[model samples]
Target: MPWLATAVTTVGLLSTGAAHADTFVPLPGGEISRTLGDGTVVTVRLVGESATISPSMGATPVHRNAWVSGRAEVQVAGGIKKGSIQPGYVVGCQVDIAGGGVDGGASGKTDWEGNASGGLTSGGNLSLGPGEATSFVILDRESANDYGDESHSSANSFKGSEASVTWADSTIGLSGCAGYAQARAFVKVKVQTETIRTVVTLWGQPFSLG
Candidate 1:
């Protein structure tokens, strides 16, 4: 894992004669390798992760906003090479999301759904009170189904041994939370081999939303 110091800069001024600053946080993305029952090794990597925290347009203490970016890569070896990757983020309002009760490694089988303190949403814009959290997928790809009907999916499928997904400037807006807030990124990969199928997840470092 590679770590970089976080950087903050004053981007502009607010309407209330207050100096508004945007915080740029450089995250140390991670990598993890998992071995399947059939001796297949699946590797997941998260790279170039960062977030820009900006003051919300509401300009109130209860409102927060951020722009996140990252890249997720997957490589499968020694088995049938087909997999899917889903990238997402979890936002917490006054709730501990610092990998508590979860494996604190480059990759882990953390139960994201169980750890979430609130209901999940399809989009980034959210509202939560204290001690609540939610997760949302970043990709909403639009495509035609087999019958030529419009469809939307959050995961991207790929064949062969290697595939990657990149996202930039994904918006996260939170309101109704009057306390401190935090967020973390995750990449979930599902791999299928001739003998078995497995899923691996990679979690990024948690960052503040103040």
Candidate 2:
């Protein structure tokens, strides 16, 4: 199985030019950028992302499984407000399987609902393990902590300091969620203060995983 980073694939960064929303462009090494309506820019450069599929180690023989993991450095610059009341940009990733897990079709869903950590290299070295969460989820922490950098956010851990964040590897064992699929790392910005109401997001190009 070969890794499909954006640099080598035809599925390059694509975004909407419309003025109503944010812009997204895929970058190399799973990187992506989102420009907000207020001219604020949030960049998320993925150091690496990976996925694994295998028979479950659980005693239950009825299911197989796949685990998806992502890691990246994030930052915010220009037009960012300080001490805003709304939740700031959210940096995270998700998995979209072709087979759709155990159901193997339209009935399958997205989201891995796992715990996330913040740092400079939290998810960069994650690997499939015997014990893992049942689904994928966004990184959630009450404070704004950088991966030892100078970043700050009102509601997320990735505010200041080009913090590193990761959605630790999680399992998707339904038949519909099995097989090869695309994994996407993305960023979202939401600032709802008394003066500005901007919501924008940028999704990095998808990569192959099985």
- 1-210 per-residue lDDT for model 2 (tens digits): 121121111111222334322222233544556666666666656554554544443424333344444554555566444311111111112333222211211112212111122332212122322222122223322333356544322223222324444443443333332333334444443433335555333444544433
In model 1, which regions exceed 4 Å deviation? 1-18, 100-120
Deviation of model 2 at 15, angstroms: 40
Which regions of candidate 2 deviate over 4 angstroms? Answer: 1-29, 56-62, 82-155, 175-185, 189-195, 204-210
TM-score of model 1 (CA atoms): 0.81
lDDT of each: 0.74, 0.34
Cα TM-score per model: 0.81, 0.41
Candidate 1: residue 68 Cα off by (Å)? 0.4
Across 39-93, the per-residue lDDT of candidate 1 in tens digits comes to 8888999999999888777979999988888888888777665667778888889
For model 2, the run of ten residues with the poorest summed lDDT: 83-92
Candidate 2 lDDT for residue 173 = 37
